[model samples]
Target: MKTRITLLALLTAWHAQGQTLTENSMADSKDIERIVVTGSRIVESIDEVPATITIINRQQIEKQLKVSPELQTILATLVPGLAPSTGTSSNSSQTLRGRSPLVMIDGVPQSTPLRNGALGIRTIDPNSIERIEVIKGATSIYGNGAAGGIINYITKKAHADSKFNGQVSLSSRFSTAKFEDSTGQRIEGMINGQLNNFSYVASASFEENGLQKDAEGDVIGLKYGLSDAVMHNYFTKFGYQFNDDISMQLVINHYQSEQDSNLVDVVGSVNSGEKTYAIKAPAGTDAPGEPQGPNNQNVMLKYTDQALFDNTQLVLDAYAQKVKNTFFYSPVLANPEQGYDGGQSVIKSDKKGLRATFNSLFEWDDLEATIIYGIDALNDVTSQPMVDGRVWVPEMDMENVAGFLQSKWLIQEDLIVKAGVRRENIDLAVQDYKTLRLCKSVDICSIPMAVKGDTLNYSATTYNVGVRYNIAEYFQPFANYSQGSDISDIGRLLRTATVSDIADIQTQASIIDNYEIGFTSVVDNLRMEFSAYRSTSELGTTNKYDPATGVYMPVRAPQEIYGYEALAHYQLADNFDITATYAWVEGKDTKNDIYLGAKQISAPKGSININWSPNELSSMSLTYLYVGNRKRFDTVAGEHVGDKGPINSYHLVNFSGQYQLNRDWQAFIGIENLFNQDYYPAKSQAYTYSGYNVKGLGTTVNLGVQYQF
Candidate 1:
């Protein structure tokens, strides 16, 4: 604690001395080139975007790196409507505006779900990131699964300078808050070079993380039960400039992690009757509980090109990715009968797939346009080896192929129209195998369930038409309509199929539509954006397990949700800045008696965030999040129990600063949760799992140093 205070004191003195130094030059308007993304398939400034967006640059990340213990936590607190909570390896999903948002590296899509490793999104090392761009509204250019918006992590590329540059950094964190202590170490290195018409860049990072505890000193396992793990990432890119109007580039990236096993604790009945919470052995478990390990790997490749013809320019790009997931757990059925001779064994699942996409951009006339169309095709192949547990047949393959097109038209300097459409087809096939009890000289029982090679075709035409009119030099009004869809996991309930039934197999996917409108304005250093929206989800097949048959059945109803968000930011001056935002959501079951529906899984409203940075002497951020009360059924028969009532709303306060000891080096310090407020995240599992929901981490402190040459 004293070390932090001393660092702050020194920072104050250093800033005082620097006050006499000339301030960093502000970027010229022309020099600040417009930033564009696949979001629209066309280039445009942040202000020209009709959808809500929050741009977090390298500078912001660097500032946070000096204070925050983890980059993931920093994102949740900084971005409005982006609430990233702690995950149990398998729960590392990110929700944008109350819906699961898609994450991409450059333009490579990531395939992560329940069957994959539990590493949270935070697993990506922030040290290698060049910038993080977040689009807060729905997007059509990115295709399926982008209903909640998208987050693009753009990594560092080879610099255009004709000189070689290299950098190496090492850092560590010893303690967070007074209670939740943690230790971490990281090594990062990068090299950039440019010569003639060619340029190349390569970077790698390796980090080891120690277990983290909460304010109450309870060990919260974000990476499973094992507290320590290691992750490595590598990136390389080569670009060639053929002529003044032509260029080509190729890029490769990879990430891997080694982690300890994670286990979920299920205790005995806490309440009475059928509504009680009991640690019942999963359909085939031997004992009361079991352990599971999570592991994953990702690799991506891309090719890009640029050309100029006449008065118009063209750009083309392509990307591909391969992902593999392995999960290890103890099966329940193998040990169901206690006192049985056979002991417990582990069950394994392997899921792997690939994705590819291509896009293009063009400009000419008084109208600048961006047209993007691509396809996403991937396969999920999994295996389950019986180990005394509920032994089920292995080898399942599921594939989905989608083709889409989106275009943007700039009719005038301030008027633009965008539209998109996509058609998708999914094929699922599985083989059934029966176990013969050789000792009995016959087959005891056979589970004749499998996907009999059937294909489900789905098509959705989603379009957004909006106008952004500059009402004045400082204000703009905008509005648009957007739609999204969800590819239901129908194979989970298709257990009655056989090779002969291939022709009779049937499946359906869910589609979600959203209508939105709002206005934004920027004057001097103040900026404000607000939008209202309504969204709906047509449930295709919601699966639930049947204890009697040891099978899963699909529900016959759909769901809907509606919400709105308002955000504001102000740079009071070169010496100070402040930001604030709010969101409200109303989720409901449009077809069933169930009050919570699937929507209950997300938060129900009320969140505020504010940040203050004065002259760099010190900066602080504070946030308050509120989740409304809700209920969910315990079983197909039992009434909903212990509805996670309006979980307590809590506050988080953080402060950070840096002190320059010399012109080239500086020391940094910061404190999180200054008030030590206690609360639970919107992702807390108390709503269904065990009655005891997990609590958010409390206050923490960080100290570090950096030397720039």
Candidate 2:
């Protein structure tokens, strides 16, 4: 009773601060401020870039965190052209611009491209991030695994101006419909400061989640679930300035999240209209397997010289990463003859890389140009093996070497042109292995075949060109064409091989060609942007269901994908503003003349945001999201096959607020699904696989307080 009363009291006080509005609380200008962007592998002005990039700063991140601590929620809420989150531990259904994107931290890659376990998005906790930069187009800027673009997380740095600075935060989460066992808690702390030429920052965080319940007060399904989960993260960075022109920095991070559920999944069939859910288990209903999640570790060292040779800038980065992801147990791994009823699999990867870049600046009368050239070398070893001593995919050792040159030119201070080219060479080696003989029943099983493995080689050259015209303050136009390659996902192909000779395997490097055109307009208190894009590849990356084997078989076919996106923002009053965004995408297999399934495409999505800041001490925001229906596949004999089920529309509303109660304390609250809407997420509705048609989160509330020192 006291806790509820205290929460109401805090809410009342926070609401009172916004009861009256004044002109002093309004913004003074309509000018759209610009920030530096690192999407091009260099810090450049936003207006100078020819593509759409979303930059979420620290203030924006903090505001969003008040509503949900999950990184998937934040990405779905802020990024356009990205699929909605699956509301689970896996991101297999989430793609950027109808394709998979490469995730990175401080320019170091975190994704396991060799096999793509789809667990890269949650490698690090959101609290350790200083900002998120998203580039929404294809290019060879950093190398392969960027066929859809790049999502880079920049880490926090020390407060060099102060001797010591720190912050501590505590928060709680619970379901509004029922709070019996649906509660969670989080604790986090960070410290940073500077001494002489040395600066350092460090942080630690921990969280434990209780059971998850739906709007109907039923426990959510346990497949890929987050119930009864525990997480821990540690991060640190140190820097030393040798002189005014040279410096070095070192960074280390470790993160782990695993679900140890007490409730078991009550599997349901989608065709029968039975939704999957969970319940309190009877005696010994718990499944056999290790907890499902990821364990990731990353280390990086950087050296910078601003005055290299007195005319160029030099930056060198060396990084290493180790990753492991475990999936839930299933009967698909049953091999009765081999003394194994069922088992689970784990994907393990290790990567080490080095990058060296040189930037040169030139100015001649009215033309100013910048040239950037670099070389990247990396080695990655990845494999998938069953927990019960069996190899599903043999270990693959890959070595990649690449060189790139990019340049930007500004002519007459009104026209900008950018171009770049990259050359890549990759080699993969695998030993001989045999395919798993998975059985659906005692009498029915897949044929086991001995496969031959040898070294494979691939080489490609990609190019990009673009132009941006600053015609006037009210209008700007841009156009660009770029190229990138899809590499290292061949592990899926090797595992499903039907041939015995390594030379007869039908596979090749998938070269991607991307084209884009867009424009931005800023008039008075309104700003708008629109862009259209098209991407094509020789081999499509998609999988089809094999009912006999209970497996998803990979399909290689020619593909074409196209999409469009729009954004608009208007300031209604000095203290109020509104923004809207929309995205639509479609894809088809050129060879078969059939629409691609949900695995590679997403339904139309839109969102509107209303922000109000009555004073510096208080702020409030309300957001609305809408997903439209999309049906591209016809049912075969009244059964939706594979991942091509029909998708239905849904709506959601969210609210967030924060108030400064005192000089050293702050209180905040966030409510997701404010109206407690009952619906299925897009991915849940599009996949007919068992134990997948789960409900989205209901009315969930988050409350927290922070102290600054």
Winning model by lDDT: 2
TM-scores of all candidate predictions against the true structure: 0.77, 0.94
Q: For model 2, how does the per-residue alpha-carbon lDDT over 1-709 read when each residue is reduced to its tens digit?
A: 2332233223222111211111332222111124333556766667888888777767667877888777777887778888887788777778888888888988788888789878878888888888788888776788878888888887877765676889999999899878889899988889988787787889988988877767776777877788888889999988877776677888899999998876767887657777899877688676568898888999998887766865567888899999988888877688899987877898999999999988776777778787889999999999999988899889999999999999999888778899999999998888999988887778767677798888989899999999999999688999999988777477787777767866676668788888999999999999899999999999877877676766677888889999999989899998899989999999999998999888779888898988899898899989888888889998878988777888899999999998998998999899988998888888888888778888888888989998999
Instruction: Name the lDDT of candidate 2.
Output: 0.81
Candidate 1 has its poorest 10 consecutive residues by lDDT at: 14-23
Residue 258 in model 1: lDDT: 50
**lDDT, model 1:** 0.51
Lowest-lDDT window of 10 residues in candidate 2?
Answer: 13-22
lDDT per model vs. reference: 0.51, 0.81
